[model samples]
Target: MKRICFLYCMIFVFLLMPNIVGATQSRDDGLSQFMFGISYNELLDTGDIRSHKAEFLAGEEIQGVFEEYDTLLYDKKNGYMELHLDASPCDCPGKITAAAYAKRNGGYLFLRNKETTCIYRHVNGIVASEPITSYMPVGFGLQMFLPEHFSLPKNDEAAFFLTAEIPRQGTTTTLQLKQIPFGLYVPSTTLLIDDAPLALADKAKEVEQINDPQLSLENGSFYKTYHNIHESALIFFDPEQFNDEAYPTELPKKELQDMLLSGNLSAIGEKDRHILEKLGAYASSYPPITLEHMSERFRFFYMVYQVEQNLVWDTCTMEWDSVAGRFRITKKWLSRKKPASFLEFLRDADFWVAAC
Candidate 1:
């Protein structure tokens, strides 16, 4: 009787083991889904290519806010700035409405809502023209033009303040984000946002645990310059039409390099040519910057291109050029792996920037 009971117990334990193991794994997978980069295709298509996975979550009161790039491209030339608020990734309880403001005198009542407009427009990448609202799969993006005759704020100040309101059941939750980069309106007070959400104490703890470097880089000088260069590159090479055969022939390789050095953007096609022309004209104001005279901080931007475009061999020996007073490429071997994109090339060269 004892032997028979032991056998039965063993069978029961074996039957339940798979269920226990599978349940834990399923929960882990679900948690990872909310982590980051799961929406890369969506973000990339919409030109929100910031890959750093810093996430800001709010408790049950509001769905989470995910920023692809901590920074928005500041288009000094066009006088209009755009932001993509991705609420699609979050689970919403109700409708979410937002407004922009300029912080002044410890309150957010300076800039009136009438000065801003939420319009659906995209220069390139994913076609997300829909204004951001609750429970949408595609997410929301808006462009706000600077008030007429207002100049850009002095270096690295908050352009304006953004406030998000979430109405759940009978209660309404108001969330504010601070210290955003350059925008049209200027506030008397700096708009540095406190990372900790005062509403949800528990969720704010989770946000505090994220130690992403991109958080700091968002406001750094290198990042700002990198964004300008990277976005300008996209304008010149519009990734959507990049694979098109006729596109490459439209601009010669030398001309493309010159464009970068001179900070000029040439319109490649009829699509959004006007914007391209504006960008081109604006970029032309900067004097020519050559690799030889490029700053050490920005040298990686040029080196990545050299390794991909100018390198003849997969491997090369650097020899000191006495006359040039710099390292010169001597021998070359075939690269073991070829990168499909500029970001991939940067990684392959082992000179990766956090933003990339």
Candidate 2:
């Protein structure tokens, strides 16, 4: 089964053929900083290439509260900067347009996740353009940047670079990027969320505890559910799209239970980091992650509130251990046996800042 999945992943890569990959990729011993690149199919005849120009303004403001994308930044100002391509004339589909590179050692380190995760449309302040319909899958080598070849790290150096292929120099869309600070508008002081309905243990107890999952795919099974979140106030989890059964009920952990009962989301992240990681990357062959059945083989399960994507998932895994006779939670692995979650894979301090 794993062999088949491996072949499938290879085929998937072959199909995309990635005009180029590696710049955005990290070595098993290295890390990947977010890089953006723009590319255009080069002209067939000319060894000569045209030049395009655009400018990015730093510190632009945006208003709508979007997830993941809400946090934005510039390369240089935050100790991160784009790699200078020198704009040499070139002709090829593989040619790069523009890219963002981490400029400082602090910038390149995965623990420092200083790369941009999403772009926002500036309307007074960063606002949501639209919910992303697609995501850049892992193990695909951060699709946009081109690989950089050089000796070991520099004395005054950041190790990674990002590159993009720009269209013929005169194209209408000139490349302009800005590094901005991310500010979350949670109405922190003025408001509080009502997680009360969700923490009702009595109601949860009334619901049957299942030994099986609600859905099982080649990747894994649906493990848990997001409780008390409304179909309306959320960008994801529209009731119209999913039915009650698709969202599995979880016996809220002590941390979440307290938050639900108290209306405070503070420090809730401190205790359940493991569960959160599982929720983010648990395998699912299905798109948009819909699970449909259950089984005892799918015992260990949990859910996480994904602030990055403003989405949520219930991670289900068959892997578990009993330490000294009590259930011991261990990190889950994907079908390929790669570390299953992004948070698990990266384990960077910056990610904790952005994600937590």
**Top lDDT hit:** 1
Where model 1 places Cα greater than 4 Å from the true spot, the runs are 1-219, 239-306, 309-335, 340-356
Worst 10 residues of 1 by lDDT: 119-128
Tens-digit per-residue lDDT, 1-356, candidate 2 = 99999999999888776644544442211211223222222211112212111111232221121122222222222222222222222211111112222223222221111112222111011111111111111221111111333112111211112111222222111111121111111111111111111111222231233322322222322212221011111211223322325433242444343343334544545334333323322333322222111111111011111111111111212111112211121222212122344234222111101110
Name the top TM-score candidate: 1
For candidate 1, the per-residue lDDT at 34 reads: 24
Q: What is the C-alpha lDDT of each candidate?
A: 0.30, 0.22
Question: After TM-score superposition, what is the CA distance of residue 25 in candidate 2 from its true location, in Å?
Answer: 13
RMSD of each: 24.8, 24.1
